[model samples]
Target: EGFLHRWSSARLMGRRSPSQRKRDDCESSGEDFDEDDEDDTENEPDTRKRKGGARRPGGGRRCPCGPTGCQRLVNETGFRLPANPERRLAWLQCWYPPDSVPEKYLEKKQFRVHECHFPADAIELKEFKKSGQVVRSVKKDRLPDVPFAQIRPAATDQPRPARGERQTREAADATRSELDRIREWVQHGVETEDLPQGSMEVLTAALAQGQQERDKHLRTKERLERTEKRLSQILSERDERERALRAEVRAPQAGVRGMNALSYARFCTDRWLKKSMSQWLFFDAVEQLNAYALLLDGYYPLADITFVPRQRAKKTVPPADGERAEMRRARVNYPQNRKPALALTPRDALVFWLFVTRSGMTLSRAGALFHISRGTAASCYVTMTEYQLQILRREFPRLSAQQIRDAIPDRFRKFAKQQGVKSDIGHILDGFEKQFECPRDDEVRAACWSSYKHLYTVKFLLGMLSSGAHYFTSRGNPGSVTDPDQVETSGFLDLLDEGIDTMVDKGFLVQESIQKRGCICWMPPKMRQNQKEATAEEADDTASIARIRIFVEHAVLRIKEWGWFSSRQSLSIQQADLHSDVVFIIAMLSNWRAPLIA
Candidate 1:
């Protein structure tokens, strides 16, 4: 009877199950329950005692029958329980302990409960129909009973055929009908003496057209083959000549190498020189190269760190006169007095360094291409890099506030005025990072790890003028350093004075530091600590500031395009000074390009 009542009530009340009803009641009553804990309670009744050994205070003794004993207690007490088994177990556990309860109920029952079952007549039928006493489901505007005649058509009593077989039969029927119609039409036409004219002439013309297209295709294919063969021959000759040049360079004779050099120069035409110079040497024209070579004239006898001699070992005793005399005699016997002169001039050495810097080629490969030893190549590279860095620093010094104001375009001046930007705005600042190899030491690795890039990197802060020319580039710092900290330590603040405004992106937090130096820092508006987003006015200010400040990032990109910074080899932490000098030189050289904004 209870089961029938439950079924009838569920069907009449929108077909919701008892568990869903219980959940709805709990939600309506504002009773929050831990569903996960209830599921565990049903799976293992003693989960709490097993996991935490926690017992409820002032509760009955632990029941040996586990969940079954608690359920019986709930029935005896006439306590309402949740419909879900898990939730029912959880509710019972709250009232009764694991031990069997010994409570007696005094409340009298108001209604009789009895079991309900189907009659013999109803059970005898193979198909059971819902009794009239039971309620029918009417949710979603659906009928409870559907007639068999309505469900299936009487004319089509057979089961449906497979899709593939059905489609094949339909296609065969269509083709047969179409063929019969055409045959009848032709028979009628023959009886009436009507037939298509010029049929053979149309067929002949189509065949001739196809033949012409085939001939054209054959001619095109033959032409392509001939062109490919000619190109292959040229490539083969070029490879042969390159092999002979390599052989001459490797030979010990200077004359052969000199002749090969002359031949190589002769092959490099003006067009080839222009293209190769811009790509491999970063110079636009031969005249630029000539002018650059002139810059190294006064910096004669450039010193290389690699050539610095090690400290002399302490002599225990003075060399013997006979030993010294024997060394002199041995030196005289060797070819060329055991000392070979340099094969390249100072200008050629400088060009060699630029080639290495622009192409990022390995020192060994560069040395072979230039017909010099690896050690000599290394010495030249180091020497030229050091001298060139010194010259660039002097050439690209930071501009004063007045010079920056003069260089800024008139359009930018008007925009700055409209945007309320100070007239003395000088430089825009931003920072960038270059990825490096992870160090073995934990401290070094942690220090170099960059959260922004999600890799180990070195960071540099760059400052550019409104005209997009870089004026200040900081030495490389650990990637873990923040933008504000890098700016403080990079000595850029020292150049700022009162009335000179410095622009920076939103990442910079150096307003206080810049103010301390008596300079105004113009950074984009940022959301406050308590705010989730900036106001409309603040967003407008940020957009206005970004319009001019983005050029600094563009300038930084130009600096990073150099082969040295973009090379596959990672920067050495041990030689941080050299890497810093390289970055400084590249940043300075980027100024030679046209302005980014213009």
Candidate 2:
């Protein structure tokens, strides 16, 4: 007891422990110790060593002295409090004497000390402890400064329940914590009662703001829920409509329009065909349709109905000179037993194909309209489309240079004269865009996105003669490609002959390319960067180009007039492979219309 008392007194007076004094003496005397010396030191008193036989520092462990017993050590040593509020209070309680410990700190639960650090500025700790002064009493009634806000714990701190349960618990916990904090702040403010004037007004304003924020959050949440409900309802309605339509398609029909020639002719009148011509026939006149059908029948195999004449039963007869008659012998050997059928006649099939092409309707709808199975309709449609496209491709017109010159009206010559150029424009060229569905592929999507159309599109170059006939249509390219790139790649330049002049829109920057091809390109002059407006000569040139180029646009309008191209539902991703063929067909058909220039 006496030795322990003397050691504690020495430590309080800033004197080194006996073990530390001996170690310093050994280090200063240049003495070398072996492993045995370290073993011997473990037996020494006041030697704070761990189980590994390593000596711990003096301040490494928590103080053995109770909170009230070591007040003098804390105040005299000038140690700063811990940064954490709870930790700081517990530390102070451990150091201060029972009478001197603050009353507010006494309410906190006891905290276990894990480790302690010596203050960096405690170099004079021994000097200050040696000349100890009277210790001051800690303020007993002062409140511990608690933060008004805290970050919510991370959700990843523990495994979460289901989504709904987690959300409900988090919201409840947040509300409770906020309310508790506000109540504590109010209590603290009341107890302190030392706030400056106008403090109550600030508190009231803060409370009102918090309330308003909570209400706003609630309103936003409600609005989101309602929007989700409405979207779900819309999806359900769409699904129901689809189901109903499918049921209607599966339903049997007693008799349908346009199933046979008689019904087709009766139901498809000029007025009715006119009303539906753009979507069904491309021609309003029945006579024109019949003529086209007859022309197609010559190429297409087999008629819809064939009348096999019945022969009267004749007695067996042999040819003279022992040579059997060929017709009589074949009739005796082969018998005609195939039955004639009447579901879709060649003319009606042509109309069906046109309807499918123009309307772009599903095969099922076309089959239902014609009182035939979907497979049969598809077969007929494919057959007719191939046959019709083959015939149309051959008939598509092209004007020679001489024909173009002869077709040019007087107005074009007047405009060319005004622009100081010869009135010998052979053809006009322009690019047209058709919107299509966005591609899912990253590279393909980027290629097809058009800044001009502000959509995913495919662009085609159309060439027209002075007479406004669509003489050529280049294959489709991605919309991102420029007009000149399409022109250079689409083989449109191949059609140009030396000395022939071509008119184009201002978008085409193909003057150099055309010059290389031994052809002259006439397009509007662009204003210089430094010049705001075009000069008088440039203005006349632009006006003349516009007048001549207007026909190309009219030709494009005729192509767009097809109901398939005019519909709101643009080209879909599935049709990407066939888009070139379809556009080419449409461009060719546009030439059948009356000449726009004449």
Which candidate number has the best TM-score? 1
Lowest lDDT 10-residue stretch of candidate 1: 109-118
Give the poorly placed runs of model 1, Cα more than 4 Å off. Answer: 1-273, 298-339, 572-575
Candidate 2 lDDT (Cα, whole model)? 0.65
Clashing pairs in 2: 68-97, 68-98
Q: Count the backbone clashes (under 3 Å) in each candidate.
A: 5, 2
TM-score against truth, every candidate: 0.52, 0.51
Given candidate 1, what's the lDDT at residue 355? 77
lDDT of candidate 1 over 1-598, digit per residue (tens): 9999998986896655445555667799999765665554444433213221222345322322233222111112122222344443433343355354322211212111110111223212133366535332112222112222343343355565675663457655765565555457667765323423443343344467679999999999999999999999999999999997567446432355544331123223546645777677777877776666665554444322233224444444544678668867876432322334555656566667777777777666776677665666667677767888888776776666678778776656776689765666777888789888788999989999999989899998888777778788788898999888898899988988677678888889999998887777888888889998889999888888777777776787787777777787876555466777777777776677676877
